[model samples]
Target: ILEQCYNLMDFEAVAKNTMKKTAWAYYSSGADDEITMRENHSAFHKIWFRPRILVDVEKIDFSTTMLGTKCDIPFYVTATALGKLGNPEGEVVLTRAAKKHNVVQMIPTLASCSFDEIMDAAEGDQVQWMQLYVNKDRAITKKIVQHAESRGCKGLFITVDAPQLGRREKDMRSKFTDVGSSVQNGDSTDNSQGAARAISSFIDPALSWKDIPWFQSITKMPIILKGVQRVEDVIRAIEAGVQGVVLSNHGGRQLDFARSGVEVLAEVMPVLRERNWEDRIEIYIDGGVRRATDIIKALCLGAKGVGIGRPFLYSMSAYGQPGVDRAMQLLKDEMEMNMRLIGCSSVDQLNPTLVDTRGLSMHTTGVPSDTLGLSIYDPLVN
Candidate 1:
């Protein structure tokens, strides 16, 4: 029954009502009209599935690697700040569940759990990645990097796009300002206040592409830049020696009018091929990835793996760590089930050929043909 409900509740329901109106607005609201946000999911709807029948499936393996670290599934939870906003234990719950599921869980600098505490919670599972905001003060940013290294965090993911947080109308309309109220960061017990301070210190208004080298100089742990949407930035990331790039529109929480991460994947992949860096680095993404088939589509489209954010939070909010475990398990199970149905046995086998993109148009409005647009197998139209 829990599993059924989990599958039935889309991303919105998991977020609705549980979060205070203000926090919900902020976290759920995309940039402008949320055109890109809608498109991200809409684009997925445009692809049709062509599942091959008659495949033997006595056993299946959903395990794969990201930055060479083996994991139980092809997707991992992205680091989002203020878990306490959803549950009291906050980051601790997420870390424990992630460890149990054998997946990487990145911790935001604004994480409610102190870096050391969260690290300890992982119980020697160093698959955790630390997200650095790369604030104005290099000293502070470098210190956080060192802290992550000392805590055994496996990698550093620098969010390059947000110099200043975007204006989310939903949050504005929520008519409240307490996005982070449960956990304390500095002298304040208010998570929202702490979040404000954290972002203020680390979000350097002058941050630029050149600054990535400075981060590279400070730590040898692989650096992954999140929020990459354009091909030029992808090229720049490769030139900067980034180990990976998450093609994201900040989960449609950043740019409302921006292109969906899925739409951008098409543009980014060819440039990546041109760079001939496909063999040298990893390219992963997460946006509108609500089902097992969504994971398969991302992989087929050229993502090395996918990151899950809001959905995991929804699980955590609904049932704490157990619920999170269930969510992760369901995703892995769905991936396995979908893989068998499609006549593929592993994560690496999915590609453009597995799904059809014909006659599919994506936007905020409804798709031209639901089957044509969203099927794993391309739809045939006469």
Candidate 2:
């Protein structure tokens, strides 16, 4: 009845009314002011597609690989914890959907289901990546990474933005709690720590570039540092010897009024190219990718792929598995259609030249070709 009761658009409304108000707040609220959250969506609007006709795209394909793993599309189901709050099946249902879609599933450190349970649900049929939070103790962090590696998890994504949790006033006001939940693997689903208290409990806010090797020594799986917003940080990540970077601001769930992910993408990509690490490491963006066009825009700006969090959550909250499936299909369809319309036969062909960024300030001067201690040539769009 619930599945039939909601369409993709109606998922959020249904979830909000049916799910606990506090859980909804935790899942939906952004950082203070949500200024960046609002801007993340708006930045996509600022990019206009210059779709070219005369191209024969009788059949469109949305198949691509992320960081050497093949997928039905370019997007991944981002790691979010305590999905049981949204639906009884919890991460199991989400794992099944990602397995079915042939994409990646990031299992959060705060997952309500234990790693063993989530892996059992995966059934060795899909790629699962572990998302890490710097726990209060380095020993615990290493233990989680080792566990993930032992379980055949393909990669590790260390989310660095929340060394301390940000001020999510909405969630605080809504008063969410996970007291009754099983709290799998001794996970802390409560945000009572806030961002600061939470990180303070675990990761040292003073964590530095020197610590990257500390994590590297733990496992051979690829490491992707998420929440990289600055070029200097990007350089630090590269120096850290990680395999990839996911330019994000935690879906604007961390810092308020921070630069949207796209804005950061434009800045970081050139640095990668100039540093001669453009293809050396996988680069991805994930803040405001709500549509296929948004995905294409990121590719044009030089991202290997994009990670989508809230939109899929919105779908899951709205209609469970079916909503999740429908949302993935919509994004894939949009990407394929936009690619064909823009005369690009494949995702690989997408670049800054395919779309016009004439009105944006950064485009007024062409983007720099060299990034390290050198002047970059910012291009002018006519």
Candidate 3:
């Protein structure tokens, strides 16, 4: 199986076959109908590349920085909940892989491993960001923030989209009950927590723009909003003095018909460039990112980097650390090849002139939902 694996979709197939039913459902399923989830990847098809020829493409470099944290690649392992559900080692396995690869890992607030457990797993001073879901109690939120700063978390990414977890029907149907379902490894999942919603209540819906200042005063970590969806929000994020914004829709698990992150990026970047504020804040997008071509498309359209969640989760769930290792390595190989083929030599060379976004808004609808093919096809794109 390891030798057979090629890309993210291959790992998804392995994960589907290997993961426990409940875990598979939670990791793979999206919101109602999953139109946005599938569209997340399909939206990339809309962008066409205008590859140039005869450039010095022998040595391709995709290394770059995010929020001032330099990484070996232009992507990071984005935050996702519940690692123990698929692997016994939990998020530490991910931490180890991230360290091995020298890319940033955004530790999830709802991780099965304790926050310190994840931080402690890092090799001395590896760049790790904290993905915070604001606790309803300000005191608890403050404590989490201060502790992350103490642990030397380099970036503070406040998730602003999901005030409430969406109705992930597949996860709901697959929720474990009784015996082992009550909890696993004695982590945060306590019955409903184990099932899903118990921790959802811990997140405060009242988190607002006014709260940004409070977050700033508490920690010196660069503050980034992770779910800004519109051009206006990106502008507001710049004005708010945050370090960056991730133009994401929570991997299309929040709203059923929400726009994909890349689509939103097409809308947001022009506004930033128009206002001469592109440099004011680092902009990124996640969701439907599967291939190196997707990464190039994003970079060409002006993203600092991308946040990838499920592919790594799928790889880790199926083959553990080695699976993750190969997944990232495959990306590096493809990134280099794509960069060479596209006639660019470095991360700094990617620009809007290299791609076309005229069809970004032409959302493809009425595509048939193949149940088995859904598992075999890209987990993100139906």
Top of the candidates by TM-score: 3
TM-scores of all models? 0.86, 0.88, 0.91
Report the number of the highest-lDDT candidate: 3
Error of 3 at 342 (Å): 0.4
User: Which wins on TM-score, candidate 2 or candidate 3?
Assistant: 3
Better of 1 and 2 by TM-score: 2
Tens-place lDDT digits, model 2, residues 236-317: 6766678988888897888887777777777676656766778777888888777788888888888888888766676676
Tens-digit lDDT track for model 1 on 1-382? Answer: 3455556144347557666554565456676688777777777887787766676765778788998899888888887767777777888898888888898998877777777788888876549888877756688788889888877778888887676666556655555445335433323332342233323333677988778778889998999998887666676677678899888887776766666676667656654565465776688887877888888887887888888887877777767787788888778778887889888887777777887766343442242334322122211211
Candidate 3: residue pairs that collide: 189-193, 189-194, 190-194
Q: lDDT of each model, Cα atoms only?
A: 0.72, 0.73, 0.84
Per-residue CA lDDT of model 3 for 79-140, tens digit only, reads 98888778888888899999999989999987888888888899986999999989888898
Error of 2 at 140 (Å): 1.2
Locate the minimum summed-lDDT window of 10 residues in model 2: 373-382
Mark the regions of model 2 whose C-alpha exceeds 4 Å error after superposition: 1-10, 179-182, 185-200, 359-382
